[model samples]
Target: MRPADLAGVDVLILDRPPGGIAAFDLLETARAGGARLLCDVSDRDHDFEARIAALGLEAARDQANALHLAAVERRAVLALADAILLADPAPDAVLRALGKPLLPVTTPADLKAVLQGGERI
Candidate 1:
């Protein structure tokens, strides 16, 4: 949605990687329009690159590479995000570096509950 279209939106939550390039722009736009932006960084595992390489499988290696790239993209989304939800425990150093708000999320219900809390949004 365009920035104008986000007017009065209560919350805008997006899954990175699935939303791809457009998600980054949308997060910024929605935030500008006074909507709360939340990013779910659940696609990439914490030790994806390292663990996949240790498995010694060609296909797994490729998947690891792809996950690494996706992690890079997630960083951009995190920059625009108002709050962050993690599928993995303690995000990597990059996320720690950004230092934006971080929230725990184990399931869809967990995320929904946080959104409903009405504090961070």
Candidate 2:
């Protein structure tokens, strides 16, 4: 996949690789898959933003009120997206329960398989 395909994508993938890649890798892959990155932060306010900056990813602000809001918004974005990839490992229950086009964040192969087709992955 290529980042150019991300244009007009509504769904955002909060990709959390099993062994995390650099922030830029996440940004590039998500954009390539035709989705935005719904970064899930477990740290102090907007620390994830620093990572985004480090990676040089430009995106609109989507600060969630709470973790649940983050999850819901992520799901909402995915539901509307051509694709959505799960990157956040915590709250596996939330991510898995939402059921809005998901791929395990554990491996690149899983993500590639899922993105190959919107369904049946």
Best by lDDT: 1
- lDDT values, one for every candidate: 0.68, 0.43
Candidate 2 lDDT tens digits, 1-121: 3455555665454533212234345455666755544433232222333334444433423332343343344344434333334455444444445454444445777555554553452
Off by over 4 Å in 2: 1-75, 82-84, 87-91, 118-121
How much does each candidate deviate from the true structure in C-alpha RMSD?
A: 3.7, 11.5
Write candidate 1's Cα lDDT for 7-118 as tens digits: 7887887765333667656666777778777777765443446546665687775677676666566566677777788777677666677777777798778877888884
Give the TM-score (vs. native) of candidate 1: 0.64
After superposition of all CA atoms, the RMSD between model 2 and the true structure is: 11.5
Off by over 4 Å in 1: 1-5, 17-21, 45-57, 60-68, 107-109, 118-121
Error of 2 at 52 (Å): 22
Lowest lDDT block of 10, candidate 1: 42-51
Instruction: Return the clash pairs for model 1, or none.
Output: none
